[model samples]
Structures are given as structure tokens and as C-alpha cells.
Target chain A: MMRHWPIFFLTGLLSACGGGGGGGGGSSAPTQICTELNTPQSFTSVPLSAAPSSQPNSAPVTVEAYPTYGNGNFNIPYVTLQVCNGTHCVTVDHVIVDTGSYGLRVRADFPGISTLGLPSINNGSTAPIAECSQFLSGYAWGGVYSATVKIAGEATASPIPIQLTNDPNFPNPPASCTSSGSNIGGLNGLGGNGLLGIGVLIHDTGPYYACSTNGQNGPLNTPLNAILTNPIVSFASDNNGSILVMPSLANYPQGELTASGTLYFGINTQSNNTLNSTYSILPTPATGGNATFFSATLNGQAGPYPASFLDSGSNELFIPPLQPPGTYPLNSNGDYVPQSLQTVSGTATSLSVATDTAPLSFSLLDVTAGVNAGNTAFYDMGTTNSATAGSLDLGMPYFYGHSIVNGINGAQIQFNSTTYTGPFYAIH
Target chain B: MPYRYRWTVVLVGAIVTGTTHATLGGLERDVSHEGQPIAFAAATVHPLPAVPQGVHQQTILNLRSITLTEYSANGTVFAILWSGPTMPDYRSLLGTYFPSYQQVIQTQPLSPGHYRAPVAIHQPNLVLHASGHMGAYQGSMYDPSAVPTGLSITSLGIEP
Candidate 1:
């Protein structure tokens, strides 16, 4: 089992900071196996139990985990793909559609994908390439490979390159990446087949490297092939960007088990992908540059949460928890609110958003409340922050009934073609 | 109780030049905790089989992106560090210390734009300091009570 596969994604993440290594004179305890955090549950693709009518879009997007591979609490959506070398294609399902991360990472030995005789991506070296993808808590270690990745039956432009997790070529993860992260990439630890990150970044700046047979390696910069790339930017026809269209369970407390949705490719290429003229743009943050590529402000307060991006990979509205936890108003059900009506000067409190000052007011929900309860989707909600590095991850719950658009990093979409660069996010 | 807001140090110290917080990748000698600050006469490039055991001797283990050195007190773990590709998993590493912070994670809101900057969760029992991205994943936490009498946390690689 090539477990520590995702470590290559965050090569210098630690070194980039000024410190290196822990202190001495201490008896190091063996890292205890966290059964709760590392439980490998078998999840099946349960049909959308409370299935909503499928939205009018091209491809089928599912929030259901493949049976035997469900990620415990993260309500991430999945899509299937047919990756091939010409006609010898294998259909790989459960690819996470992530807007938070950049590029594609698939399990090298995943059940069906390993069968395909995909070519090794050398990144200019005869020796194989490895990557250390740093997650907030851990890293994904894997190697690079080449293939044509198709979504919704349409082929991505060129021979789409991707990260082959747990590269069979370099099954042994170096001690460096493993000390910080887990032994999961794609199918092993992470609950999906592979991830289809269609966010704005064209290439993942997360680290990748070339490895020698005896385990010697270094930082690699072979741009076109070494990095996990966002395929939307590589598409020939609808080349601009894409949008996730999910219906609003606005009032549904506990979200439905299976909410049918569609992930439309390209923002304005087709009739249904047009921008909603009446909607205001929240603007893709130029906040972290590369760090926190999509940061957001809570209420009117600004950020310390870097890694904040619209993610379909997460399960809830994951932002830094507000202090005191009392400033926000609670609804009758004790659920924190997204927008509430309160009369400022009168003797009564209004309970509707139409009131003058209640348009985007949001609140937190009870954390222990299972997503299946009537208290599923949360907007004003924010949860605990990762002490190591903080981020405000807008998980799957943020997509309830919203059409979030990501304009590719350099590609322009507006009719003017020059107003906005690719890599900006817009919600309608 | 004041340490619960140790985050203040994280915010303010980031601006202070040369003050060690938890920058793992560039970790240097024990300036704060050491009887006197000194550089590694010879740094080991190979990784240790497991974290070595000792309180006074520095056990440096090299990993891909970062290296770790553990500070000990009579075989009791006092501080654990990380510096490299990314940060370590605090949930698992922190063990019992994680619950309280997880339950009542409170921080004073700062001016705008500092939101994504970095934060320090200061508590009496355990102090957590972290920040950075790919090349800069740095952070560390230690129990003040767990430290042996003469040792300083700064000497253990954490900034006071």
C-alpha cells in the first residue's frame, strides 16, 4: 500500500517559513494511530435518497460517495471521467470537483485506472517524478503521469496531464513528507477516486519533484507536465472557466442525502452558462497571491484565514469561528442565520431578510448537528480553525442553490475580453 | 489566562525581526532555551529511525521538506516541532490539548487583510503558533508545565 502519496504537494511549505525541525533532548513518542481520523469506511454510491430533479446541464455531478469509500463528514461532490490513451480508456468515478485546490490527482493503483497503460511523465528526467502536495494538516505524495482526461464524455484539450497518486514507480514515501501528513492520496485515505480541481489556478504551485531510484530527488520545474493542472484551462472549445450549478435547499434544515446537481463547464460558452446580470460580484481575492488564492471577509471583518476558497470538496461553511459567539443572532430553531430581519428602532424584531439591514446577515449552527438533520446547509456558519495554518474553506454547503463561477487565471470571458483575467470567482 | 491570547505574540511577533516563533524550515540553534545560542557544528542529513530520546542533546531528523528536533524532560515529551513542506497534523499531535482549543477557539478580530495573515492560539496548558505556505510551513506547541526546570521554550525552538 503506497499510503503516504500526497506529500509531494507541499515540498517547501515548512522550509518556506523561517524554522526547520523540532528541538532536541526529548523522547519522541510514536505518532498514535488516530482511528477516528483514519477510519477507512466503505461508502457506496447510494442513489440520491431525496433526489431532486436533475438540473438542466451537460454532465452528471454527484455528492454521493462511492460505496466503501465515503469521506465521513465532508459532503464533497464527485464526477466520473474516462481517462485514456486513445481508445483504450478506463472510466474512473468519484473524482472530487474541487475549486479550493488546483490540478488533477488520481490514485495510481485505483481499481480501474491502474489497468490503463498510461505513460510516465519524466519531467525531463529518465528517473520518475514525485510530488508533495501539502494539505492544511497533511500532504499528498504521488508521482506524475500523462493521459487524456475526459469529463462528461468530452475530451479535455491536448493530452491532459495529471498527478498519479502513490506512484508505483516510487512506492516508498520519503520520511520528509510523511512526518507531517497521512498515508492517503486519492483512493487510499482520501475518499474519492481522484480530484478534478477546476479552480482558477492554471498550475499547482504546491511542490512536486523528480526522484532517483535509491530515493534521491530534488525540486522540479517542468511546468507543462510535472504539475497538477486545472483542465478547464486546457479545454479547446469552452476554454474560459466553469461553474457549479446546485439548487438551493435554502430552507431545508438537514440537507438531503443525495441532492442531484450539474457541474457546467465554461462560464459563458453556452446559453445556460451566461452570467446572471442582476447578481453582484463578490470578487475573487488577490489576497494571498498564491497563498489563500480566494480569501473572504467575515461580515465586514477582513482575513487572517489564508487558504479561503470556494470548495466543493469540503462539507460545510468552514471559516474561522467568531469570538464570544454571541454577536450573531440566533433563529427560533437556535440555528445561526445567514440573513435575519431585525427592527432597529421599533419595539419588535423583524424575522425576514427584506428588512432594511438583514440582507446578508449570517449566523452559526450547532456543530454536533449531523448534516442529515433538518439543519444541513449553513451560510453564516464558521467552524474551528487549524492552529497550524488558518483557512476559511467554503465547503459543499456553500453551493446550495448558487451558481459559482471561476474565471480562469489568464483567460478572459466578458464580451470585452479584457476586463477580467482568468482566476476570479463570481457567484450568481 | 493571558496566554490564551498568546495569539497576540503571533500577530505582533511576526512583525518583530529575528524573534523565533515557529518557523521550522530555517530552524537554527537553541538561542532561547540553550544555556547559550550556538549553531550546529555538523547537521545530520539522514532521517532518524524514529524521534531520538534525550533532553539536552538535540536530535535532528531530516525529512523531505522539513526536519524535526524534539525537546524532552527526563523522557517526557515537552515540545514537538515541524519545519518543511507543510505543517503537521495538530489534531493528532496535540492529543488532549486539542479539545479545549477546538471547543472554544477564540481570537480577537484584527483589522482587514490580516485575516489570512496567521494566528497564534495562546492558552495556559498548551500554546500553538503557526503560519506560512508551501516553502514556509512552520509551527510548534509545548506544555509550559512539562518543561524541565532549567530549560526555556525558546531553547526548544519556539519563540516565547
Candidate 2:
């Protein structure tokens, strides 16, 4: 896809030249093209912490509008990761800190990962077990391998199963996997070194569990332990959930260059990770339709969308359009472009307990302005939600000023004198 | 009992080719001919209640955790709704239209600040909406021209 950019540029130039030269004595204003502002050389790495904290439960997270690696990403929280098998260890930087999916995935082409020689999980067959981790618009297909995953000072007690996306051993993914969507298994498409999914779910199953054997579609017969397991659940302690704390980008209208925060591993288990009374706990069903989704209602629209969720993986706040589709102008990227700043407000109610609701709101800005301004972190960025009418996805922008807690399924959580089970979200 | 048993055999045989051939704008029979061996490893077919006057709806539950619902009218399939852990095999589901959909998606411009937005395509004759994360996903696609008169696709209750 990146290779086509030059051809597109050439075509645009030819068309512009023809339009200008064909007309005599007629003048047209030069078109303003919004391109990526940050060059590869201008990119800089977010300095890593001096040492792994002895706290063993928290890690520093950094958000850069222009990261040193991959494409320039915005509002994406990243953390450094250390993967080790016996003595061979490789430390990877700029791994996405996502609370929308489970388990950890690293690019096979990432530095030192392939050389780490992580043991492949075969499930007793000579054929390596491969998986297709599907996202909304893309997928990562690769072999399942085991390695000790460490974030800051916290490490998985045992070598947990992880997906080495784009594993060379499985170069050609079956048609079933590739047919799903674009392959974001590389740095450019993924926009990061890898993904560290620490969402509400403990195990990533469903279509993700349909593993292929030696490039052929087949049933995954591997045990749960051997599947791509969430490393946070494997921690001896602080195993229940995680908290993403990003600084408020409210003051930066044009957007900030870099924002830093903390990712705590547990909920209410440590003083630094405790859930206080100020937080509203929204419980989601452990099973059945839209398991981790709660209900939300946007102002001036319908009452409640039953499948709403808080997803860090999504870069923008996705909701039903406030007006009709054509009401607001759209930029080339399809993001809503209001004539002026527009504010959309809503309320997210607990699926299990309707009374437990969290007030939500965000501004929508002109996408072209933000891009032209050369900023990565925009507070007032959003797009329309077209997938499910009964759902709204409040993305990373919602987490900027709040401490959002994600409790894993079946984990016990005590907050404000109430004992709540796992599979819940608390907004503070 | 014999009639039902024979119907099961026919369904299994017809579905073997369903995955690669079933598509919007195709005949209703095309859906019956579509099936994925992995999803069919354990499959259940459920007929949904008809809503409007001329539409027929059916939901196919794949053991792999995906559900595909087909809407047909006058023997033509005009719409499809899918919800599950991963996206359905669109190559088979969209048939000839897959390439057009793929082209529109691939050619869409990418803004550095926002890259992970949901996919929504609204063509003159075709409309598509798809989005989700890892554990949960849902989407719907329909042809406006083939749909029965006075019927809205949203009236089909196509929530994932």
C-alpha cells in the first residue's frame, strides 16, 4: 500500500498540471495537500525508564504523536516489553498498550524476536499451529509460540503462549485467514512494534481459536494453556486486571507531541491501583451476546445502545452520527469535519445495572486542521460508528483524563465496600 | 422423520460450496450452496421469523463462533448480517462484489492521526458497515436496488 503513494502523487501532479495549463488567463488557487508532517529522521524515541521498578505492578506508558518506529501514530499508548526464553532475551520498544483485545503479539520481523528462537507450540503435531488474530479492518496471521513476557518488573510466572505474527515458518497463510482483511502483521501497517492486549477477557477464543495446521484450515486441538494466553493473567499477583492512565490532552487543541502516563497491572490489589468510591463500576456479562459491552446513549439520539464498550485499540471515538450522514463534511480519511468545534455527549450505563452510568462527552474537530497543524494527539477527533446501531465504541480519547479499569473474567474485585466479579469496567 | 432426515442430508451437501459462491445480489439458492468446512464442523441452521411481507430470513450458526444471517426476497438474497469473534469469509460472502469492496477499502486515504476507524461503504447500489476488536465483531451489508419496495434494511433488526 505504501508503494502506491508515489504513483498517486504523480497522477495528482499530472492532473493538476493539465488543469492549469489547459485554461488560458484563468487562475485557480493552489490545492493544499495534507501529507504526513513528521519525517523518519524527525522521529524520536520516548526515553525508557532507568530501571524496572521494584513495585512489580506498574509500568510507564508513553504516547507520541510521532514515534521513532512504525508509522506516526496518535493517542496510542505504548510500553516497552521484554520477551525471554531461558537465557535468550530480547527487549522490544513501542509495543501498543491495548485494552481492547487479549494476549500479546509481536512482529516476527521485529529486531531480535526471530533470533530469540521462542519455542513453537505444535500441539503434538509436526505441523506448527498457526492463528489468525482478526481485527476490524486487518488481521495478524502467524504461529503460536511460548515465551516469558515481562512488562516493567512484572513477568509471567511461566512461558505463556503468544503469537509471533508473520512468522517466517508460516509464510503463506491459508486463504481463510488472508481473505478476512488486510495483513497488519508488519511495523508499517500495525503502526507499532507489536501489540500488548490486556483487555477484560482472560482468554482470546472464538474465531481466534480456529488454528490452522501447516497452512491448512483445521480445528485447534490445543489446550487452553497452550493457546495465545494473556500474560497479565499469568502473573503470580496483580493478575486480575489493568488500569490505563493517560494525561489530559485538553489544553492541546492542535494536539501534543508526547504524553506519558502509567499502566498499573492490578485493580484494588495494591494501594497505587485501588478503585476508590469516586469511580463508577459498570458490570458486563461474563457470557452471552456482546459479553464485555455495556449500554450507552448519545444525546439527541436514541435512548441506549446495548453493546457499547471502552476500547483503547480504536484511535477515535466511534458513535452514531449526530446528524444525518451528509450533515457534516468529511475529510479524505472519512473523519467528521465540522465547520466549527462540535461537542457530542452521552451516557454509558452498566449492562447489568442500569443505574450505574458514566457521563461521556467529546469534541469533534476539523481533521484536516489537525493534520495540517502537524500534531499527533488531538482531543477532538472522532468518526462515525457504522458497524452496530446498538453500539458505540468510546476509544482512546475517552481515557485521556480518566483512570479506566478493566477487570478480567472471573477475577474478584473489591471496590468501595462492594465485592464485584470480573468482566467489568470502572471509570474514575 | 424420514422427510426431516433427508432434508438434513440435502442441506449438508448443498452447504459444502456455500462459502465461495453465496453473495449479495445472487439468488437465494446461492446461500444454501455456501458453507465453510471449519465453520460447518459444528453447524446449526435456524429460520428467523419473517418481518415484512416478502422477505425470508435465516441464521446459520458456525461452531467456530460466527453467525451469518441471510435475507432474501423473491428468491434473491439482498442482504447479509454477521456477528462473531472474527470477520466472516467476505470473499465468499460478497462473491463478485468482494473485489470492489476490497478496492474501496485499500484505496481509502490514511490520515496519520486516525487509522483504526470502522469501515463504512455507501455506494449507489451497495452499502456495507463493519467494525469490531478481537473478541467481538459485527457488520451488515445489503443491496439497495434488490431490496423489496417500501422495506428498510434496518427494519430487519440486524444487530450483532
Candidate 3:
């Protein structure tokens, strides 16, 4: 038995904008499990069944919240990585879900998993253990290992990867890697036992492999050696990808009321769901690239928004860069660097970007707000030495009170206007 | 929704022979990998991850262009997928469509005189079909004008 591991912003009412940043309150006594948003009335906790291809074209499917693990202390609704060696299936229950980074990372202690026998990662000179600190998250350090990860009904065979955190050398892990030290604002809470990232990029953390940056083979570069596989890639039939559909919420009497949404497993292939023809569609970057909106103009110019992304892996809502007075200072590698702020500019208020469209403006909502902005350890914006350097991230704030869908075939995240009509509330 | 067309046009330069230069087009979307066509005018100087330097093979890069055929449904282009000189492509929780097409262009690291300027275009020709395709939005294209002599054009098509 081994413990798993793992790990947003915005706006203004034209000035009455509240302070936004992804963080949690002081560490409470370890609770029993993860906390889930209030379930929606429209939602029915359908039994977790195999994702069926082709659903009757109908209204959105309401997904019930799965059971929470880690005793509900921000560790509920955990995703499991089942390692199967053909005959037997060993489900790793301590797995965490994340959308900040891509790829599935499994531990080596699991029943039927094997670590890739990669050459020792030496920084050109010494053969040191290769570790990787991904963007906005802690350093996933350990020896390389490979395995076949099965999620739901999907799986990827003998993926190249690494398994750290539980490694001895990694003992006394940096706060950057553990909840005790580096993680600020209680975000470390979202850093569950393990992570299942569902971001819109291809390579996790902007493709900055150790070989690329330091000529060393690190986890980000050789994640396959570290058990990093896209869970969607391992599914059965509609394995191409999945989606996350949410409801369009309106601000309630107490400002933005708490709302809920659904998470699906496949695309137009699900029996309970239908690719809604009404909402807008925005195309995200291929892999670990930045999630760009469809406009170049600042202040709402870049659009094709109301865009949906079915990412259960992240802890907050990651929008695009906002305008001035919107800048935030962040720590990278150890040095504090200023994050550039770009506005979402466009003529149209509501927009959607189809499959193949030109590039546009992309902004991100700060996800660390309710956690307290004054706290420095609240947010760990990606590494400073990353190939695709940026200070923005989508976290729990992005999912708070929203109906979200995940694990679908076609890669998309939609919103149902009926369930969530909103005035957007504070995530405290 | 106001129909606004957009296109990407690379700045043209005299294609020099004998001297190999790295011609960089504007940022286009690489739909195949959910990445952007990041063109690096000056590479080969340093080795970056994913982007291996030193012209191992005459790699084929898909030169692409995005056309916003319609905006009646409130649609817009999201990202430009390019490698080398720009942002790396990423994976999404859910998959998506691509506005740019993959053009297989034989590209290699720069040698000498191996420098190309960046291309830029505001909006260009993007034709929608006759069927029920609504013509409510603007369209655009991105094509390299300064291709070296003796180079052959393999495939050319407009992405959604």
C-alpha cells in the first residue's frame, strides 16, 4: 500500500473586481476526505457504468459526484489508475486528478506496474537521479519506471515513466513538492496523493524536457519512463479523447451562488450526452502548449469563449491574461518574476472557436482567490526555467460551483445554459 | 455576430540559392498535434528539447493557414500551433478541432545566409462553400511567399 501524490484568476465587474488567487486556508486537522461542490438538482448520480458509444441526441447528462477518498480533505472524488498485467487489476485508490499538467503519473509500488529501466539521469557530467519539477506544481522526483495504466475502461500499455515522492532520496521533499513547506495558500491540499491531468496541451509543462533545457533526461522529458500516460489514450472505443460539460451559472442573490455541473468520459459517443449545438466551441493548443482563445485584441477582443474543457485534474479555473493592474509577482525556480498580463479583447461578447481556426486572445481567471491573496505560498505558478514560460494557471476556482463533464471521446467541454445561470460567487 | 475574417501572411524575401536560410512563416495552428506552427527564423544555434537541432533529416513541416469562414455562431480562432521558434503544443482534457492544416515542408536547421523574416497578415481570402455553410464570419490564410528556388510545393489546403 502506497500513498499517491499530486497537485486561477479573474476579473472585475468593471472595477468592483475582487482579489483573485488560488490558495486554501491554514491547514486544518487532516480531514477525512475531499470536499465536493454542492450537487445540482438537475444531476442524478448515475451508477459509474461503461461509457457507451452513441447517445440519443438529448439535453446534457447530469453526472453525480463520485465517492471522495483521503477522507474528504480536498481529496474527495479521486481518480484511480488501475495497473493491469493482463490477468489481474490493481486499482490505486490514492490517485489525484489534475488539469494543470498533462499525462498520467502512476507509482511503482502498484501491483502490476514496472519502471522503465532508463539510464541514470546525470546532468551531462554526474549520473544523478533525474527528477522533474513541472509548471506550477512540485518536483516529481524518482527513479524511472513504466507500466500499463487503466482508467475506467481505457488504458495505455507499458508507458515510459518515473515514480518518486515515495522515493527515499526525495525524503524531506521541498515544500515545492510537499504540502508542509513550498505549497502556499493551502493549494497543497489540491496536491492530492497522485494527479491525473486533463489540460488542453499535448506535452505537460510546455515540452521543456531535461534533454531540451539541461541535456539531462528528466521526468517532463521522459514522463513515459515515470508512468505518465494520457488516460484518454487508454480508453476502449472512443479513446481519442473526452470532454467536460458545465452549466452556465448566473450570480445569485448573495452574489455568485454555488452551482454544480457534470463530467463525462467520451465525446458524442456517450449515451447520456449530446454535443450541444447551442454553446460556443473554442480550440485549445495541441498538447502542453498554452490554451489560447480565438482573438488577438485585448480587453475582450480574443474570444470564442464560454469555451468548455473537461478537466477534472485541475483545482481552479484557468482563464487568459487580464489587463493592467492585473499583473502579479510570482516565484520561479526561487527567484520572483513578474507575470505578464494580457487582456481578453474582441468585438463580440460571446464567442466560440471551432476545430480549425486562427489564433486569438486567451485570458485566465486567477484561481487562488478565496485561499487568500496576501499569502505568498498560495500559488506555485510553474517553473521559471520552463520552455513555455507563463504565470497563468487554471485551478479549482475554474471548477467551483460549475457543472463539469470529463472522460469523453471527442475532446470538448460544454456548458448547459439551463442548469447554471450565474452571477459568479467567491470560492472561499 | 459580426463576421470578421482573419489570415496569416509571412513577410516575403528574396529566396537565395546555394545559401540555406531558415525561413519562418507566421504562427499557424498545427491541428495534428494540438500545437502551433512556431517558426524559428534562427535555430541550429542552440539545442532545445522536443526541438532537436542539427538538421538530422530534412524534416517535413506542414505549412498551414487558418480561415475563419463563419462567425455567425460566435466562433473565433483560438491558437496558432507552430514549433521551433514559438510555443510548444499541448494536450487537452478533451480533444478539439484545428483551424490550421498540416503542410509537409522539408525543413532543416539553418546553415549560412540561413535567415528568414517573419510573416504577418491581417486578413486574406477564405472562401466558404455553397451549401448551407453560413458566410457570416471573416476568413484568412498563411502561405510562405519567399520559398527558395527549386523547392516544390507538395500540398496546399485551407483549414477551418
The candidate that wins on TM-score is 2
lDDT of 3 at B109: 20
Instruction: Order candidates by DockQ, high to low.
Output: 2, 1, 3
Cα TM-score per model: 0.61, 0.81, 0.39
Give Cα-based local distance difference scores for all models. Answer: 0.48, 0.65, 0.27
Interface RMSD (Cα, Å) for model 2: 11.3
Candidate 2: list runs displaced more than 4 Å.
Answer: A1-55, A66-72, A206-223, A324-333, B1-21, B26-50, B109-115, B158-160
**DockQ for each numbered candidate:** 0.07, 0.27, 0.02
Question: Candidate 1 residues A174-253, lDDT tens each?
Answer: 44444342455645355677877777555565444455443323333334455566776665556566778877665544
Between candidates 1 and 3, name the one with more favorable lDDT. Answer: 1
List the candidate 1 regions with Cα displacement exceeding 4 Å. A1-57, A68-74, A186-188, A214-224, A282-307, A326-363, A367-382, A386-391, A415-418, B1-126, B129-160
Model 1 fnat value? 0.05
TM-score of chain A of each: 0.71, 0.82, 0.47
Error of 1 at A392 (Å): 3.2
> What is the lDDT for A152 in model 3?
54
Candidate 1 docking DockQ: 0.07
Candidate 3 wrong stretches, greater than 4 Å: A1-77, A86-88, A107-133, A155-164, A169-190, A201-227, A245-262, A287-314, A317-394, A400-428, B1-160
Which 10 consecutive positions of candidate 3 chain B have the poorest summed lDDT? B129-138
Going through the candidates in order, the fraction of native interface contacts each one reproduces equals 0.05, 0.39, 0.00
